[model samples]
Target: MTEILEPENCFCQLASGSKGNALYVKGGETAVLFDCGLSGRELERRMAERDLDPTTLSAVVVSHEHTDHVGGAGVICRRFGIPLYITEATRTGSTKKLGKTKAMDIQAMECGKRFSVGSLEIHPFSISHDAADTSGFRVTASSGAVLGIATDLGIAGHLVKEHLSGCHALVLESNHDPELLYANPNYPWPLKQRVRSRVGHLSNEEAATLLDAIDRSRLSHLVLAHLSEENNTPDLALAAAYGVLNGSNTSITVAKQNLPTPVLSF
Candidate 1:
């Protein structure tokens, strides 16, 4: 189903964080969930909240094997009979994690290769995350609108920056504030190290640096996602972003942990 008469970036972060994560991005004739991190029921409710119908989805693309990214993939695929796209390594790693599903089409994809799902052209790139294999996506809609989604990643290296550059919109990871993370008494030293590792989430500074490095001159929309509830606050995250993007026209929205952000059109 076409969302608009003209080609535009139709996007939303259904949910974002450790508890769960999901995102919706639509093209004129094709719609997809970048990650279905919630249960089937919860996913349905959120979609309903956004006025999105599951029947319209062409596929549920899996970025990695992490529960926060792949939890609802199986159930949604089974219930709706939507196609599933994932790398072979990611599919294998998610076996036990993503429950069971009916006999559905499982498409294999690899980093550096580009594929299309109806109206969206997608390019998957390697991302540094502690998964069997994690992918960051750069998607272009039929309208020629480009969107870059890179979350659940540790470091934003040269490859990631190259892939994400010159997008009309981006959903990036601004996972935590380093000071809060280090000082949080509830987290053990080992857990902190893991979170601070090159394979872990991005801190506010790291996220800002990546933003500054990327070619955001053409970027109109920015959604900061996968924030840590225990160690990060919206104010802190926004502060870092605002500092770098000062005097810029790019709209910034920090994704929420409990609710979905309003539908964003670019």
Candidate 2:
């Protein structure tokens, strides 16, 4: 007798960091991207390397209007002929930043609304971030597996905790280490203050606090994303999350700045 494996849901972190961000998620017949912070060429290359077809992508979803979150949105949508799902304010605020590209299909997504793209159902929720209309997502696959992604958020509040609870997998931001960030002489006082503010990135402690509050019984995978290159390291971020998730069945991984992570299947 031979062992067999099942074809499960696929999730890949194509890139993550202050410099860029992109994610690829597929369930059933639907393939979607959460963000396209990388260049169009880089995103395509990474997807190809991961054996994912760009033509099969159902849509490109935007989380906010930040350059690191929407840098490649316009180009990727135009190239793949896929619709760009984003808030009206995000589109309006990002027009000049996303640059002048050919017209592409745009779908307006409001906070707290549910929308479907192929075999996945996405629920967008407002998050506290310095953007036109920042959002976090709770995506459910046709198979009932759920993935929660909340990055670039200053704080993981009640709403974020509510949406992220009971997820099969989570990609959360652990952007900085408070001690390291505060000690770094390179960063000015005001810049440091902003990074620690309510509308700034989450510290390692903050991310861990959020994890402590969320339901982890159903979680199989935990990915720490959007780490600050200058203020954090993979080992530090991993330790912070491990402190909260140690001795659990869940597997943890860190999303890096320069490359895509191995595809995680549920």
Cα displacement (Å) at residue 88, model 1: 0.7
The TM-score obtained by model 2 is: 0.95
* Error in Å for residue 170 of model 1: 0.5
lDDT of 1 at 91: 94
* Tens-digit per-residue lDDT, 1-266, candidate 1: 87633235588899999999999999887889998889999999998888877888889999999898999998888788888999999999988776764477788889999999998999999999999889999999887889999998889999999988999999999999999999999999999999999999999899999999999988988999999999999999999999899899999999997899888875
Q: What's each prediction's clash count?
A: 0, 0
Show model 2 residue runs off by greater than 4 Å. Answer: 1-6, 100-102
Please identify model 1 stretches exceeding 4 Å from their true place.
Answer: 1-8
Q: How high is the lDDT of residue 51 in model 1? A: 82
lDDT of each: 0.90, 0.90
